[model samples]
Structures are given as C-alpha cells and as structure tokens.
Target: MTMQLAIEVDRADDPRLQAYTSIREKDLTSGHGARFIIEGKVTLETALRRGRFKLGSLFLAKSRLEPLADLLAQVPQDVPIYVAPQDVMDAVAGFPMHRGVLACGIKGDIPSPAEFLSQGIRAAAPSTLLMLSDLSNHDNVGACFRNAAAFGADAVLMDAQCCDPLYRKAIRVSSGASLWLPYAHGGTGMDMVNAAKAEGYEVWAMTPRAGARMLGTLRIPEKLAILLGAEGPGLPDALISAARPVRIPMSSGFDSVNVATAGAITLAHVFGQRT
Candidate 1:
C-alpha cells in the first residue's frame, strides 16, 4: 500500500508550503521541472490519460483519493502520492480551493537549433523561418513561436539574448505550442542571417526607415528569413543596412506593432504570397 500522508488544510499557511511554491518557480526558470499544482480532478485525470506529460508525483485530498484510484493505478507505484486535507492544499497554494489533485512531471530536453531546422524542412512544404534578434522577454519569445506556428511559419531562430522558449511561463503562455514548434538558439542574429543565406533564403529585416519599401509593396522571395528585433531598439543598424528593410503599412498615428504581432502580420503576408 502507498503510504498516505495527510496534511491539514491550515498547514498551507506554514512556511514550508510557501517555500515549496517559491521553489517551483525557481526550478522552472533554472530549466528544472517542478511538480504542477493542478486544481480540478478532470484536468489531472485528463493529463494522466494523455500520457504525454510525465507525472512525477501527485497530491490529493483524502476524500478525493478513492475517486481517483483507477487513475492512480495508471501511475508508477513508486511515485509519491500524498493526501492533504482539502483546506491545507488550498492554504498552501494561496488559493481558495483545489478541485483535488496536483502532479509533478519531469522536464524534457530542448532541441538544438540544427535539429529543429532539419525537422522543419522535413515537415513543412516550403520552409518559412522567423529569426529573432536579442528579444529578452520570455512572453514575447513564446508568443512569437505561437504566432509562427499559427501563421504557418516553419521554424524560429533566436539570437543568444532571447529568452528560453522552453521556460515554463513561455511554454504556458504559448499554450504549449513552444514544445511542438522547431526552434534554434545559441546562434547570434548575424550567424542566423548567414545560415539562412547559405540555405538559399533572402533575408528581409522589418524596420521603420525612410526609403524602405512598404511590406505590401515588396515582393518576398519564395525562400526567406524574416528578421525581427527587440521592441525599443529594433534591429541592429548593421543588420538592417545589410538586408532589405521592409515596413508594414500602419495607420497614421501608430508608431509600431509589438514585435510578435509584427512577426505574425509579416508571416501572414509572406506565406500568403507563397500559396
């Protein structure tokens, strides 16, 4: 029999519970997987049934444990399954209530840029690549990938300064698309530009400058890399100077769109032209 440890609901107010929550976030940023704090029974059971996410451990209210007995059977016997009083689970998590279950899962490895690029070519018809330059926000990075996937972009390339796409917040914000999308990191923005050129891609930098062709007016090449930069700084002058700078047509008052949003619009335009 699995040893069932019961914790009181009020115990969530204890320092230990607070510590556990803090540690989980820290672990996620450090590329370590932390146990997920699942609320509803349905979500927990569904995740287990899917079998894609590795469940490390589970926590449940004693009353809810029996209802989840069959689900528990699906998990490995050695995985710790704790029973805490409903109130305790709620207090510890700083929530009003938990629908009765939580689980921990192992962190998966992030694929190399080379591996992602190869996979993109194999999977997509005509590869569309989005290269990000020094964008630091994980949310923006993840949103970019999500939009890329949605807009038919084949792969994403990140300069070294971009946030880790696999970071927990990024993954969650991306609605988990970050896991499925092919992406590369560690390469400098320029290195990516060179690689894309070598792969027979025409690099286009999205920038706001005089004499730059409007996005709608320019003819995008069939094989292309759309280069984007951080919000305030935009692309490096050298990069913009080196590649073709294209501007999206915006309303008179608007200065610029969010980089991710701009990426989506450009991707739509380019991919639309291809098909």
Candidate 2:
C-alpha cells in the first residue's frame, strides 16, 4: 500500500503532535484510534520484520536514517518518509529518544469475548484460563497476558476496567503475544466468573488472605479459571468468598509479589500438574 506523510512537527507541543501525544484512557475512549505509533528504531525494525500492521508513514532523525537504509528500501516508494532534526524529534516524543525511527500503522481490532472463548477451546485442551479483574495498568495487564501465554493458560478474560490489550504500549510490552493470545472482555469480572463456573470451570481466586488454601496442597482441577484482581486490593471479598481461594507459598517478611509475577508463578503451577 502506498503510504503518505500527513504532517511533520518540530516541537512536542505543536498542534500536529497532539494526535500522537496524550494517548491515555480518556483519549482512547473518546474514539481516536491510533494507527499504531512505532517509537524508537528497534521497535520499528521489529514491526518491519513482522509486517503485520499496515504501514502508514515513517519518521526519523536525518542522522539516523543512514543505518536504516536496508529497512527503508523495503518500504514502497509511494510511502511518505519524513526527516526531522534530532532535537525536534526528541521534543515531539517527550523523551530523549534512542531509536530515531518511528512509523505509523493500522491497529488491529480485538474479537468479541464469545469469539475468543470459542477459539481457545478449539486451539488447546479445555484447560486453565486467566481472568483479570479490573487491572488498570497497561504494563501489568500486558505482563499478565504474556505470562498466561507462556504458562499455557488457554485464554485471558479482562473485566471492563482493564486496559485494552490492543493498546500500542500493551501490545509492545506483550511482545505481540497480545495479538496471538485469545481474549475477550465484557460486563463485570464477576459475570465472567459465574459464566466460567457454568461452563464447569473450577474458579480459583489468587489471594494472600489468611483463610485461603495454600496453592501447593490443593488438587488442581482439570478445567480452571485463575481469577486475579488489581495489585493493592487483590480480589474482591465477595468474589473471593464465592470461588475457591488459592495462595502462592511465599517467604516471610515479603508483603506480596506483583500481580503479574504472582500470576506467572500460579499459572506455572497449575499448568505443571495438569493431567
């Protein structure tokens, strides 16, 4: 596809730069979808190698473009490439940048929850799954998805408050696992819990509370939904009380592992013992 350069900016606060800056939750909800921003040379090169998202445009500091010559040659001649002064590029992205190249590409859409669940059942054994409950940080959410994929969790279910898996930062942090791992989000986390139970999944809530069963001793179920909550609060009291609670064995004096780390350890255990 022919790519066209739309605008170039010399300053971060330049009006043309507004679309790329402030890509937080509020901005996304207002309906401005990013055509994927490729920040830094490494990430840009990775995207080029994969060739998944549709390339839109390329931006680079003039000094750095020489090193990327072979990669640039792969681009269609019709694609617009912009050269900017190093100072202007750094200011525009809000950091002293290492990778001078950035590109814009189309962001892919996530499938519906039902579609994701059905796909998971078809792809793998009816096994363990990770369900996130209102985990808001993009980094944490991305890490959880990465761990789930690594440890053979069948899929991920995000509650409504969780960050969008397709968000650029989350996708990057996931190393593109977010694109391949099956996931669906809708309604409250509790609703998903109930639905999993209806599907014969033994839901296990991961918590550090006193009465919870030690994860090591419990008999892992054949079909499981590993429920996790946000870092500070952990799982909701009602949710914990409803599902069988499981706690990871931890050393004394350590408060708790980060939710993503805890999830990785828990999922590894569950996958390890599967019959």
Candidate 3:
C-alpha cells in the first residue's frame, strides 16, 4: 500500500499538534464554529474522505497506523500527521482513548440552518428536514444525526442552543454519521418555526403535551420539516401554537420519548408517506 505522510511526535507538548491538545468533551466547544476533533478510526476516516470538513491535522497511536494504512494513504500530504504513544494521547485528552485515533478538522462554507432549509424550499422536489432546539446533549444530537442519515433526511436544522454535532463524543457516538450528514445551526425555536412556515413548509412540532395531532394518522406534507425540542419540556408553547403539533402513539402514562428515537420513528413514518 502507498505510504501516508505521518510525522511522529515525541511529547504531548508538541507545537505542531496544538489543535489536538487538551481534548475534553465539554471544553471542546471552543472549536465548534470552525474546527472540531474527530475520534476513532471510522470517524476520522469518514471525515477525511467526505471532504465536508477541512482536515487540519492527525494524531495517531503507533499501534493504529498499520490497521488504518488505507485511510492514512488518502490524507493530503501537506496536512501534518502526527503519531504519538497512547500515554501521551491519554494525557493530552485527559482520558484513555482506547481507539487510539484522533484527527482535527475545520468546517468550510457549510450553510446555516435557515439557509439550508430555504434551499430545500426552492428545490423542485419535496425535501425532508429535521430541526432541533435547545438540545444540549451531544449523545442525543449524535444519535439524531445517525437517524437522519439512515432515513435519508436532506438536512438537519438546529437552533443556537442545540449541541454541536461535531463534538468529539457526538461524532464518535454517531458512528461518524455526524461528519457524513449536512447540518446547520441558528435562531430560536419560534424563529425557526416561522422560517419553516415562511418557506412554504408545514412545520410539525414533536411534542407530548396537550393539543398534539396523533402522528399515526397525520398526513405528511409535501414539503415537510420536523421541529424537535430538547428532552423534557419539549417545544415551547409559542412554537407549538405556531406550528402543527404531532405526538407519537404510546401507552397511557408516558410523558415523552428520547428525542433521537422519536426523530427516527417520525422520519421513517414521513419517508414512508412521502415515498
């Protein structure tokens, strides 16, 4: 196999790998707007191959290189690839990284949530969209991304309060679909609902509170956009009042479902209807 351009670094303090240092899940938000860290071999490989994000650098454990030879070969020679021992890797990240794979990436000209939703509106064909608000959990957002990709949602629209899908844990939990799927962020819950409505979309707010149209018999719209709020106290009253509220059928006594699981079921139902 062709060799990859990988540089071996001796210490965690190496200046060349500044981007990959001190990596903790919560503290990594500083890179959300521009750069992100890709963990695990699959996530790193997918991020590089998709070209959705600019790969700034790579850090690898000595043991992982041979297994990841093919993916490594695909990385740009100009991009600095650093290999270090797992001890230093754990120290830099503040935890043991059993997978021994990590890469740093910077986002490019991806559109904002409102902008992407607008494009879907202008398109000739019907579009499937998922929107989220105040979803602060990375795992939930990651699972949502995976579900969207699996169900072929065109794009994900999230509000300013939603967790970053590119967060390392989210990216990993998503099995790397977080890098594969196209997503954008902006606005408030009400603002997003209004945007969807103005663009000729029938915004379906997923909620369990009173006044929700049961999702079972609800007709999926030709131009559909699903809006979801964070777990617990889902879509606010004003947003619900502005959009058509829908609820998944469950036995009596349940207040709600996991946001990601609900999204998956709803996306599948919408896909079946639209198709």
Best candidate, TM-score-wise?
3
- Residue pairs with colliding backbones in model 1 are 9-87, 9-88, 12-92, 35-104
Question: Candidate 3 residues 1-275, lDDT tens each?
Answer: 47666788878877887777777853554656577888887787788777477788888887888888888888887777888888988877778989898888886666666676666533555778889889999899989988888887877888889877888888888888878677877778777778778888899889886668889787667778898888887888888888888989888888688999999999999887767
The predicted structure with the larger TM-score, 1 or 3, is 3
Candidates 1 and 2, the one with greater lDDT: 2
CA lDDT of every candidate: 0.69, 0.73, 0.81
Q: Positional deviation of 52 in candidate 3, in angstroms?
A: 0.6
| Model 3, runs deviating above 4 Å | 25-33, 119-124
RMSD (Cα, Å) for all candidates, in order, is: 5.5, 4.4, 2.0
TM-score of each: 0.69, 0.74, 0.92
**Cα displacement (Å) at residue 249, model 3:** 1.0
Give the least accurate 10-residue stretch of model 3, judged by summed lDDT. Answer: 25-34
After TM-score superposition, the amount by which residue 190's alpha carbon in candidate 3 deviates from its true location, in angstroms, is 1.6
Rank all candidate structures by their lDDT, best first, as comma-separated numbers. 3, 2, 1
Query: Is candidate 1 or 2 superior in TM-score?
Result: 2
